[model samples]
Target: MDLSIINQIRSAFENLPDYRKPGNNLKYAVEDAALSAFAVFFTQSPSFLDYQQRMQKLHNRNNAQSIFGVHQIPSTSQIGNLLDPIAPETLFPVLAEMGDRLYTQGYLEPFISIGDTLLVALDGTDSFSSEKISCPCCTQQTLKNGPTLYRHTLVTPVIVAPGQSRVLPLPPEFVRVQDGVDKQDCELAAAKRWLTTWGAHYAPRGITVLGDDLYCHQPFCEAVRAQHMDFLLVCKPDSHALLYEWVTDFERTGEVQTIEKSRWNGKQRMTERYRYLNQVPLRNSDDALMVNWCEVTILNAKQQVVYRNAWASSHTLDEHNVVEIVAAGRARWKIENENNNVLKNHGYHFEHNFAHGKQHLSNFLATLNLLAFLAHTSLEWLDEAYHAVQTAAPSRRTFFENLRTLLQFIPFDHWQHLMQFMLYGENLLPRKT
Candidate 1:
């Protein structure tokens, strides 16, 4: 049972329900259309299949067949038409399978932080928007002085760690209209659904959920606690008046404690001050949830404050581990910088409308795009050759550019051959099955 990654993904697509009538346009399999769309996102080349089709005509060989096992490349419109009716949930099993492989291989060990706990950050980002293009699933909002804008958004959760560049993404929950619900979908509701769907699976692994101040309220925090999971959410002074009032009272009694450390940044010394209080009521009520509060302030040698923020945590804060807890809380930003920003700015073209079918085309294509990113991240952790070449290149865009250029001119037997050629200018050996 030597199943390669590509083969495993192919099997997942093979099980997609076919919506077409029997004996109608049987030239392309559903797997072919789905994998064809995936190939474009994988190689970061929109015309990837077109180049392969040309190569198949000229040289009787194409990387689509050899590498991706795409026998017959479908047109872009054909790909959209084939995938429009298919729900995005069908592809989730593939993500789970890949993540399982990574965990089994012990590649996910570095992602654990705060003593045997994994940090999962949650946030929402708009996927597509237009004043003209619209779908039944698109949530629309009317401007005060302009036309109504319809857009698609998703609540994305990713596994993050302090000082780690890579963040492993979990399956996203799309924010759209629900049957029998009069109001439009919201991020908080979608987040709760996501937790309910994935909580049991991840709870046993000792997980802590992280989010912005918007998620610091009782209903959502209680939802997280209901799943037997922990949380470390940003808490602002203005928003959490009751909690700050308790802290102010603690300060009056001198119960609050402070710890400061100095570090040299090759030019000057900087100061990091930490202040914390344990077991404070989060709101003004008898049944309010009690949580630990911590804040970090950075100062320069001139006693000038540089940055400051605070958070509420389910885990008790102490003098020994307050710094680590604060660092873990700060790592929440990686969900924005490392994951969302790279997806949008670094060659993924996340907001670009690749296919906006009337039904599920936009979301399905977006899922494929995200899956491509997850697959690449897995390779970075598991494949030595991939990591080597990726490090050898100047940037991420440059690495993909090299791959597309080589794939355009050369016909390789498989992914290993392509990688070896890129590394050594020749196929050194066959990939182990």
Candidate 2:
């Protein structure tokens, strides 16, 4: 609602622990370096700070200082050097704050579904990869021939709902080699870390974690329940032998439950079959965890099977709630389509290597990029002015392109003025005397 959101983020950067000793090169504070990097991501322009710096020299003021609270604009290299050592977790508080603001403003009501539970989709993605350029934090793999592959991967968790386009992401966990650990990091390990760290914080939101078949194992499901959360993870028959074996046995006696519903597809009627089995063993062990299994199959007007899928859930499957549970499980794809795809392919340039520092630069920049996305999402959710302008624009890329072009030529004294000028072409500059 207010530009104080920007200030709050600036404060988080300002409070970062400065590893550099006192010297003349301290012309720019750590906050300036961090905020400067964020401004580039926020504007979706690589030379945003360069343009602002030129504006500062010509007009004696720049949007970087006025809107983002940057005192001195730092060079791109300086930004990388300054932020490399700072842990990405330093910005986790800002992410939590963003979610709280949205919730407090009553914007999070639509995200709540499946009987008071918020669906959180978990998935991993590579942020940086290079066969030659490598860092100590990089995870490596040997190829078939000779060359090794080095990459940085992180687990992304976002709040999603069925038929919802918007997704709110939580702080990511990097999959990398730890100090005392011997084995290479993995998605499941990073996911377990994320659960251990933030699960309690989000537990009050009534979260139901969702993931692919990789997370349907016994240990991970137990971890989810241990945090007082629920899960509806994709379970494949091939990977889950014992579970499906039990399911096959249940089918012999017709112990499995089935419900078929008919709905018109605007052209003709179609049938959707829901099959479920409760209290099924998840694995072959004697102490295996028991979970509910459900499947959904859709047939077209010609009675041809068009789609089918199954899942394992912590909640019991029943005739009344099975449909809702299946829908929530299907929404997990939003993380891949709406969040990850948008960030990587859309304007965010998520996979683009902005900076690859020796220590933590790649992941740190990724975090700042995520925060920029969160900032824009918050503005769209809360600020009517921003929403109107963005909606009026032809596309997201065109919207940022207009902003960058205007900022290169015009200097606004306030963020609201920029939005107003873009919306109605109202010149808010002070009158000449």
Candidate 3:
């Protein structure tokens, strides 16, 4: 564990007012719970309770005092209870600021690319859903037998690029249907809400939001445009009948630019065909939304078609940037394959049964997990100690395995102490020999 990183995080926490004061008095002052929760994430722990116990044992064994000013460690139940009453306003903004810090500090550049075009992929994911457990913020639905069920939240991350291993998670807005709203909230609705909330923050950076076909709708496009942002939304033939009809007509006339190419990778040969429509109307209205559309078809050495996809974007069309735009649009899958999949199926066990409290616990835990992932990713990208370990290990799994084994036996005074031990030998004191 690196004390510098821990100090950075502690400073961020200290910036927020102590909830125990007169107005919002901090009933709990155990910052160790927050710190341990983050640490346990990287250890692949199943829950925060496990993290708390591990931290306590480590501290007691090492006779460790406070890492910073945070001396006390609360029980897992107290941590959950403390988090339950926390307002979203108090916690989420700090997380968002962390993302911004990572960006400004250059720790996030590897994951977030800035080139001729900046692409941001957005998608909503459910953090928790249950039939038995219920909370005030949970979205409820009636069962066929008339019993009610509840869901926790749908989080949307403003991902920078696809296939890039790292993702800077934005502060998510939880979606819960109102009591008398009489509407079922979906991903698109949540996306719209996200746009309204955090869209302005990224506007100066000029991002091109990428989404699936569901986001190609008229209203969604309008929302993106209203935010002064661009979009590259998937355009499926089944859904965009009118738009496809126009494309078909244009292709028949040979008016669209079509490029056919082929390549060989060792024993495998691949062929691709690309088509582009520089300017096409998204809808059939008098003031139609004009967009640039492109498609790519790929065939393997066997001449078997391997992949095919199409997309539309609000960006103005240019012959030079068409392929780049299409590539960025295609990279949207990375959010699912890299970020979401890694969190869910990888050692993180993102879907594991963590405590589900009455208030913001679930979301808070999820956010902490994401922050941990971000921290790990940052170390992999930036920290020399992490890089050395990764190079020495057989694979990422092996590296983490060694890390977990080390954590079980060693008691770290701070995160930096752990990192120092990993980089140099455990006997190498911070002071000179």
lDDT by residue for model 1 (1-433), tens: 0127788889898898889998788778889999889989999999899999999999999998888889899888888888999988888778877887887788888888875789999999988999999999899989888899999899889999998999888889899998999989989889999999889888888899999999998889999999999999999999999999999999999999899999998877899999999999888888899999999999888989999999999998899989999999999999999999988999888889998999999999899988998989988877778887888888888889999999998998889877887677423345456
Compute the lDDT of residue 295 as modeled in candidate 2.
95
Candidate 2 off by > 4 Å: 425-433
TM-score of each: 0.96, 0.96, 0.86
Q: Which stretches of candidate 1 lie over 4 Å from their true place?
A: 1-3, 426-433
Give lDDT per model, in order.
Answer: 0.89, 0.90, 0.70
lDDT of 3 by residue, 239-289 (tens): 888788889889899978877778887878788878898678887777878
Residue-pair clashes per prediction, in order, are 0, 0, 13
Worst 10 residues of 2 by lDDT: 424-433
- Residue range 1-433, candidate 2, lDDT tens digits: 2476887897798799888877647777899999889989888889899999899889999988887888899888889888999989899899888988888788989988886999999999999998898898899989899999999999999999998889998889999998899999999999999999998899988999999999999999999999999999999999999999989999999999999999998998999999999999999899999999999999999999999999999988889999999999999999999899988998889999898999888988999999988888888887888888888888988888888898777988889878878877423233446
Q: lDDT of candidate 3?
A: 0.70
